[model samples]
Target: MDLCLFVTHNCPLGCSYCYSTPKMDVNMTLETAKKSVDFALSHSHDEFQLSFFGGEPLLMWDLMQKATAYAREKCSEKSIPPVFTVTTNGVLLDEEKCKWLKDQEFHIAVSIDGNDRMHDCCRTYPDGSSSHDDSVRGAKIVQAYYEKFELVSVVTPENVNYLYEGVEYLIKEGFTDITLNPDFYSEWNEAQLDNWTEQFKLIGNLYIDCFRNNSPVRISFIDSKIITHLKNGYEQCDKCRFGLDEMAVAPSGNIYPCERLVGNDTGEHIIGDIYNGFDVQRMVEIKNGNGFASNEECLECELAPRCMNWCHCVNIALTGDMNTTDGIVCFHEKMTIEIADYVGGVLFSEKNPAFMARFYGLR
Candidate 1:
């Protein structure tokens, strides 16, 4: 089971496209945090993942330290190995925090939108000043400690043109695991969508060049498509199981199916709390009703096997219904597959050793 602890609903940066906006000063108490760990462990049988999430989890740094210690001890008692991870905005990461996180063997994913120009397009301080430099500084500090960490760059319509440049900048900065996430909920007209498609093609070329040069980077958007093709489609383990196998615990101890669904913590999505455990009936209702089985259009589509429309959280975010998805998702998937196939064809024809070995087990 993957238990995500939303340590706080407060953040330092004021990114415009932030879904968890209206950042309040709410924080998780130590007791609630410990209870979250206990609840998750009781449900999980073997290996488990404990992720620290937030409007900014580092805001409640002290609680994180205590909660992590409690979780490690509990996992030891249960004889279950625990995996720790955090998703941060990269501003709070310094040498001290990075070293501590490294010592603990935590997997970190930092949000920095490519380069300063692209990042500052939406991400900024409360005073409307740019946070790009501080973010880059923190990311560099983290790089020095952990051999590899994830860099998540959000792609909005405003920054669509800089997609290739932003990734190029991150690659130059030594970031290996990079994710370019498109803002699906935002309005994307023909012009922006066209630009998005073009930007991806450019990045696809970059991906090819990098692998050929033996300096490959994992860009999730492009890499996932290639992997989907390689796997013949997403495996059962690769898909999101909603509230069944994973759940996000809010600071208020209210449980949500996914972190994206934990907005304000006052919605119908509340499945259970840390104190009482999951509402079994509620869990069933969500898991059954929110899959591809619920959408006839998706089930009939040829691209259904390779598409990402099965993610309930993303569906709910875009269309406010777990059973429905938008044209943006459909369009992006088609473009990604087309580009991935092209890239794969080039690498295969050339018989690139790394590509052949990875996908075909050919030396």
Candidate 2:
């Protein structure tokens, strides 16, 4: 997990659930980007994920081009991990950018809520017009070249009932791999447990439906659990690439733990200056002590062995305590385990040994 880099904080959409809401800053300069990449490549890791995140990555394609070139130059010096991916709104991804993405071997994940109505409900241009059309067009533009990619739908109260409908639309659009993560902006409470249960029920049924139809899309969190169940892994703790295993460099040549933590009033300083050659000592200090202490829950969870604590950024934003509202998240962990156990048994049971064999490598 080298790090997930956020190219800039400039976004075109006015998504209501933008967790980085109050933290949104302006564009990162091209000069700063070059230096940050320099530091990152200097301290590259094997199997690293050089995730390009954004307001929208295309906004700084010039800087990204430099960073990509820097990665190649340094990796040629010594072996490093693959370039992980870029997650975007898919509004500006064009044919030229698509070619560059394929050339760079970058895995892409686009954010699309669902159909035009549901998507527009949350996703809109700063000008307040519907962004669904442009985003879909951009996605179609990228899909012309890329066959299978990742998409995450941010579910909300308004769209919770439409989970199945959204899945249907995504499958029809030719997406083979997709991930559904419900909106976390909604505060956590025992009262909302009913809503959580009902929404996740839709999510579970969506998986069953996909299997029944042999849908091509791979739902992220759920599919991950399926792999985990077969692999004998217990919990699903994958989070933002930047959270646990990743770091990020803003355009100012300042490096932070991840983009989510960057450009915010958290008063967390930019650990290192790429131009100053990545103050390794300072970065280590920031990455180790109080700054990183917010991940204590992940460090102490019983599931820590398998599930890395997911998102400290969101956890901190929602709950004043980093422990997740006195382990409110544990409910989700419990529910996921229950659901995974049920679905794995029903859909990929010993009776359907072929499914299990293909999916889990179990005979």
TM-score on alpha carbons, each prediction? 0.97, 0.82
- Model 2, 164-193: lDDT tens per residue? 677668778887677776566565555456
Reference-based lDDT, residue 161, model 1: 87
**Backbone clash tally for model 2?**
3
C-alpha RMSD between model 2 and the true structure = 4.0
lDDT of each: 0.87, 0.65
Pairs clashing within candidate 2:
3-247, 176-217, 177-218
